[model samples]
Target: MPTPGFPPGTLDSEGDPIWLTELASDDPNHTLHVVQGLEPAEALEALGAKPRLFRPCVLPEVKPDEWTSLPRAALALDSGDSAALLAGRIGAWTFVYDDAGHTLPHDDTILLSADGRTAASSLYTINADASLSYAVNGEQLAHLNVDDLDLDEELPGLPAELRAAFEAAGVFEIEDEDLEPGEADYAICMRVVCALAGLTGTLDDLRRIPLTVTPFG
Candidate 1:
């Protein structure tokens, strides 16, 4: 006498099957016992026909403090500012990194590779006195207000080892005289970018590929 559409394993009160029509006016709680074996979706569908017998329940709203935190995240910024808000989690700690200044509020757009393995960054800044300065990674790489080659031209007298390192690292082209605000900012940005690029490349090469083996045997 059970409902025709009800799947196997459905039971009845008093251990006796009850006709589907008999459940039309029966209490939902009672009918639910008979259809307990049905899949959740099917059970819901079957019970839906009797609205008065069953109603969907709503969950309580969750508070901000109740939500779990993510491991890696970043801040987004609007145009016009030279900087972007930065926030994320590393290990179990959260951090925020922002810039100083207003006019050119470090509004920079950062782009990362498809796998999140690489990133490119840039930003512009207007100092406290309205001087335009820009930086990347922390080093002041460039300043827009000054231009002179005196410092770079003086590199000939520098120690050979120091000069060689600068040349090899492409740092030799930056002259001390060109160390204006804008240039300083550019230099800083370049250093950070280069270092990050090198580190990423080295890590990826080491981690993703197998190392060659040399044998005395």
Candidate 2:
């Protein structure tokens, strides 16, 4: 058998579904990153993105399934020289979305970027698999392959209040076992990290929020 507190393959392995399954607009090939206590512009600046005014042309009326994806194509560069992101504030966290799938929490300096606060990323691939990573005060607390019910122990830098909330929410896995048909441990793990950083709002809430566009190098 594979390890119990961990999963069988890479974090991107095909296993339990992630928050991206529901968090995404209609596609899974995207990234959502959260930064604590920052405004949208501030968060992008900290991530080393120099955001310029990117006024896209009038978007075509898209089908419901194409709602989010279609808007992103307008943000893409014809030369492919840069990446784009949509950022907005929700509660105490700034949520950044990159339909291009390039974002900070996956970068080499991810931990350093969390020098004073927390940063977390939840990713899902086209293979229909997911993974999570998080850092606090420049220290990486956890990076897990949250496949099925196979998750690591309680996160290292989790706040006491958040821990309490997770406990009450039944977010902690008390045992190690395979997941049921529809159980989503990946989403559960993302929820804990987001809660720890004071992030609130569903994907729909985020999609509806007025967001600023930032250009990523």
Candidate 3:
């Protein structure tokens, strides 16, 4: 039998999900990231003695379901000098990586954009089938090959184009054992973002249109 998977909900001490790679170092280099549930004062404290403060701006909306979007309130903290310390201390948890290169676990919605003209949000949440639902930009685009997605339920309304894209992105797997949703969903979302946004999924691309990541408490 394929090696047993890490117990469900398992995470490293840093709060990084078991499936995600940790940052090589805590040094900041303008990479996109998110810190869940830090108050302004606490965030400021995390920033250090001095941190460039941008006027508070509402964070991007996270659609937990098709009809509801959670509007997160946040203060924009400029990198000023470096965001490493700020990133490390601002929250109980942090979901960050190089670029659109992350699979947010638990209930995190990270917003990404290419040129501000178009955007996509990768949402990872548990589905009714006990499998993870990885929806892009809150759009419920399903694949016709339900087996590839490990979908136990039917999705009569799945769009053909999305199915085609998933195939093109090599989302289908022939594993002998069950696989965690992160195994395919993260890479699939990366490819889908490229297909729909017309931009290579990279840190530079996101820098051009920085993410407005809002964390829920």
Candidate 4:
């Protein structure tokens, strides 16, 4: 629940806005949302949101010992950052997208059902370096290395049209010769999939009615 009269847009060390309120899955089995920015407050509002639309949630965590750990599916500040401390329970499959510097919050994120037909997509341009990625029935639908890709090759393995669509988004570049994309590398792939499937809805839709963000958080 939201704390009333909370004006949004508080900034953090990286200059990303702080999220005072949170969005969560209505079903415990589907309660996973991946917020793109360092703090997702701006990401939430850019989608035309007001508070109290969702249950506040933090990524669930676990303690195995004196040490702490996060699941591999949790969102990371960067691919190399060591903070999986916030692994969530959207299940084994994960959904990936970007806030694109908080420019298109609603279009920037998505949650899909097991069937892959029902989905919620925010309308926004993904970050230049962000990858679009998702899963269906625990099957990963995304590949890596947009630039190194051949239409049918393992580099991307996307259908030609989808691959072309992602290519238009600008591949995340790298100087390393042998770098393989990690989980975050798939955001752009998922973005193109959303556009192709017409899985998008207006941000206003979320404010007026209840919706579910699925797959993984």
Q: Which lDDT tens digits does candidate 3 get at residues 36-86?
A: 354333333332323344232232333233322211112222223122221
What TM-score would candidate 3 get against the native?
A: 0.29
lDDT values for all models: 0.23, 0.52, 0.29, 0.29
Per-residue CA lDDT of model 2 for 59-112, tens digit only, reads 223424543453354454432445556677777777666665666455622643
lDDT-better candidate, 1 vs 2: 2
Per-prediction TM-score, please?
0.21, 0.62, 0.29, 0.27
lDDT for each residue of candidate 4 in 1-217, tens digit (9 for 90 to 100): 1111112332212211122011211111111124322133332333333333323323334322222212212233332332222111122222222222222222333323233322222222222232334333324455344344443345366645445544443333233434353312323333344333322222222234322211111
The C-alpha stretches of model 3 lying farther than 4 A from their native spots are 1-122, 125-157, 172-186, 210-217
TM-score of 2: 0.62
List ranges where model 4 is wrong by over 4 Å: 1-128, 134-136, 147-190, 212-217
For model 2, state the Cα shift of residue 55 in Å: 6.1
Highest-TM-score candidate: 2
Clashing pairs in 3: none
Which has the higher TM-score value, candidate number 1 or candidate number 4? 4
Ten-residue stretch with the least lDDT total in model 2: 2-11
Q: What RMSD value applies to candidate 1? A: 31.0
Q: What is the lDDT for 102 in model 1? A: 17
What C-alpha lDDT, on a 0 to 100 scale, does residue 214 get in candidate 3?
A: 27
